[model samples]
Target: MVKKKKGRSVKKNPNVNLESEELTQAPHSFIIQRGLGHGHIVELTRDFRKLMEPFTAKSLQEHKKNTIKDFVSVAGLLHVTHLCIFSQTEVGMYFKVGRLPKGPTLTFKVQNFSLAKDVVSSLKKQLVVEKAFKRSPLIVLNSFNSDTAHMKLMASMFQNMFPKINLTNVDLNNIRRCVLLNYNPATDLIDFRHYVIKIVPVGVSKGVKKVIQGKIPDLSKCNDISEFFTRAAILSESEMEDDPNSHITVNQKLVSRGNVEQGQSAIKLTELGPRMTLQLMKVEDGLLDGIVLYHHHIHKSEEEKLEIQKKRDSKRKLKEKRKQVQEANKKRKEAEREESKQKSLKGMPKSTVDKDSVEERDDDVQYYREEVGAEPDKDLFLDNNQTKNDVSKVLRKFKKKKNENFCKNKEDKFERNKQKFGVKRTTQFKQNKSRVRNRLVGKTFNKKSNVKRKSK
Candidate 1:
């Protein structure tokens, strides 16, 4: 055995080695491993796997695709690389190399990833052969911005291709080259070339529309790219007036027809884009027609009908509203008239009477005084005999309104007496009402009833 053992045997039992693997396990260190808390690694691994799943073998190697790699490269230059999962367009798994920042993180401009991928792959492969992309990220951005629907479709396709992509890996910074193309079929030339088409909410581009309208908008005050787009224009007067962002400007020289002149406005496309144009088409009850690169939506009759309908609707509504207001006013007026009639009835036969008139039968005893003998104070007349002071006191408490009736029978009798005597006294007259106070002695019936009535 000693003689045979002279040669050192490196081979060991596979089963024994496998069993010892547990004993000699690799040492785990680093903060990531130290207090990883149970299952943290599992969770991290799961997330990493999920993140990597989106960059599939197919996605990365699809040479025929308007590859996401090309989009990422162009977007990286613009510093908007955060659009990896498409869902994480704002923020996600962001990786940076050194500090000489690359480009935009996302390229939503490319219509079809597959087509773009083909072009990019071919170009990249050729570039690689030429050693062009070895030092630089290939920045290719092609924008088919005329069709939001198309762009949305493209986004869906990307989502389908990379369903498991981790949204957290998205970056949105370092935007690079941007290519914007609006192909006009009528002229067969691209319109308003702005390669750097910064993405923003549609609302932000409203100001750009105004700018295109020759309003010379305050670009310095712009808050975002959308604001710039909203205020942007086609940079030509004829194109500025055409609205709804649907019309395509054509150089008459490019597509010359006897009727069509250079720099002249043409009915080649709709004023508004697809959405508005579609709505306009429905109004005309006609199907939309597509041009080579631009969309030509013909709906003149529909437009006229819409205007007519709008006017008719406005008039109808106005008439209805006016009728309602008139009815309300009529009711209010009727109510007011009824209330006034009732108020007139309430003061019927109202009176201001002298206390002595209830007892006195002789009209000669009654007296009404005048101020300064000749000046008659119309408001101070007494109904029966009463002292000036006494009548004054009563009149003070009971005001004589224009609607009051002051015991006209007594007044008539007094007038008769004056006529019979054929006398008009120039001196101030006064009568004593206390002498007729004896009239009230027999008026009361029961003390309890009187007290209750008085309380009421």
Candidate 2:
């Protein structure tokens, strides 16, 4: 009686129920999470993103994109040989996935560390699945703070992540020793990029202690250790020529011991000790790298030695020929200078007969005597008589003309002197009158008296 009966209300359902029984449903598409986290999920559908494939025309074309028209993919099969990271300010990191050695590299830029980490993780997984890690030893070249504790941390992380592969630091020297890759660390950047490791061929020799047996080789028997070394060097050079791959590396201690007086005489064998090692030369990245260690003498064949000697002899002969040619040229030049001097003196008069001219005259006389069977002395005398007569006549004429010119010049000079020094009668009279007037004026005479006296 105190409360009215509560009215029950029905709750409305937001979901509508179909009246018709026939229902059509869309097919469900399944998605597999790559464990790349939420940040990388969108990368799955990127146009440039692709999975590595075996090298084939179809596969290569399929992976190619028009977005980057200038991009050139690696020539060989697409494989992930290395993982590299670059630090950037605007973007957190830039990663590169290298292909085989000398092949093209693919790159991706990430704005955050988390996304970069996921991308790298995903790449490593793919590499493992493809068995790319097993083909070659993986070398981790980090350009990041090498002296800091962070490097150690990064190294540890890489080791833990890539346990199946052998991860090592980037040592250019050591790498050079092993391979012939054309990589220079001093001038090259290694940060934020993966490099395909090109293995080098290198040979390491045994320790010095092992190479030298009981006592050092005796050098007393030889006059000087140099002779022995010369023989050994020749032998090694010949061996190297025979085998292009062969190299020789001699230890300094062995050389010094061979030079010692005690070792020189006692050493009988021509070859090096058994403990030495000979390594073959290997090419890396189109470059020759590494050294061979050896402790023995490898001589060349007699034929090869003879050929070398012949070549040296030929070179000597060529040099001698060149010297002879130069000497002949020098002689020809001297002859030309003499000829030019003679031509220059041909028209000029001389006070005395030149020695060269005398020699030439003698030669001419001898030639006339031999070829014409004539008395050359008599002919020369007659020629001189005629020439002397002509010269005397020319001198007489020149002297007469010179005398006439001298007389004429003397007369002209005498006339000029007489005109300059002798005074004229009229000029003398004017001068006398002016002088008298001046004297009368100085004596205080009147102008009228001076005029009257001058007039009288």
Candidate 3:
């Protein structure tokens, strides 16, 4: 038997906090698809992940068998704060935005959606590999300053989904992408749009812009570079004018050229779609459940509200009572376990228990001595030397002899059987081995049989 080496026991202190502020405060999300999602829905999920950028699980592969608990199990370890779950049903597509651990879940019915590929296909020219998604996108919430509790709560929740931007230290060059959530009060819908921010110089012809951007103009048809610009009939596609409303004067220097300080720069938005037209359906407390905070389709009377409040109160009270009971039961079991452990330790062979108990390991002797109110004349325990001698004597007695009656009865029983039946016990051709088997094994019939005939 191998002996086990005892190692040092270490206990962790729960109260001592060691996490940094950035990890605790920064918002991280997991965007997942539940149920059956395919085709455009899967592409749309990928687009949404791109929009979330660096803080999200980019390469996360979710299994169909994964439940909510699987994600929740690691949420705390990863400091994930939000869950964006997309699921499809017979009714339509649904989008759920839930806060982790506990939540006031927001459910939106996707009225319509357009994938990023569809947008790129529709556009004549658009930048695809721009490093805009390296950092988080700038969140722009428009017309969300509503006075209602749910509206304010939603606005706040959206704000918290991204890291709190420091205006003073923020780099102007890093803000390359923007996410717009425009709420239309008239339709009760939110228009979601993602765009790549570009700055083009104002009043510059596309030809001149191309030349300045290091693109060699088509001078093969012209004698010189000046003639390429001089040809009146050779009006290139570059002469088309741009939107005047987009022209804005640059306040700061940028990493991308054409946006000079104190110079006019036309801000352009190339829509990087996976666009969604979402209508608010419902909002509930504690992760898609627990309590209904708001409902667009449902309305209730004052009496109904009061009844709901009472029921909620009753449920809370019952939950608290159950929690208390469970805690008490756990403590009681722990105490009982500790007490039994101590008792077993005290009654151990090497412990302060009596010598008789250590030798024989029986508690009855101790009780007998207590009952008599004195130590008995004879010890209940046998000495080591005497006990060894007694054990050897018993073993020798058991090994001494076999019963003579057993051998005598065997022959008597065989003879009685032959006399009772009145039949002759004759040896016949009782071949134990088959002819084929005997030939294969090289055996002969003349060989002596182990069985002996009875003497006359």
> lDDT: which candidate is best?
3
Global lDDT of model 2 = 0.36
lDDT of each: 0.33, 0.36, 0.81
lDDT-sorted candidate list, best first: 3, 2, 1
Tell me the spans in candidate 2 whose CA falls farther than 4 Å from its real position: 1-134, 138-230, 235-456
lDDT of 2 by residue, 369-407 (tens): 899897766546334446789789999999999999999
Best by TM-score: 3
Cα deviation of 307, candidate 2, in Å: 82
TM-score of each: 0.16, 0.16, 0.70
Q: lDDT by residue for model 3 over 57-163, one digit each (tens)?
A: 98888998899889988999888999999888877899999999899899999999999889878887877755888878889999998999889988988888888
Q: Is candidate 2 or candidate 3 better by lDDT?
A: 3
* Tens digits of lDDT, candidate 1, 1-456: 466555544566454444344223311101111122243232332322222222212122223344444544544333321222221122221111111122212222211112222333443222112121111111222333445543433333223322122336522222212222344434433232112112221222345445544566655766775656644552445544434353333332332222222333323211110000000011111111111111225334666767766886798899999999999999999999999999988764434343345434233224322324453454444444456678687776676542244676667878887776544441212212332343366444334334343564
* RMSD (Å) per prediction: 38.2, 41.4, 10.6
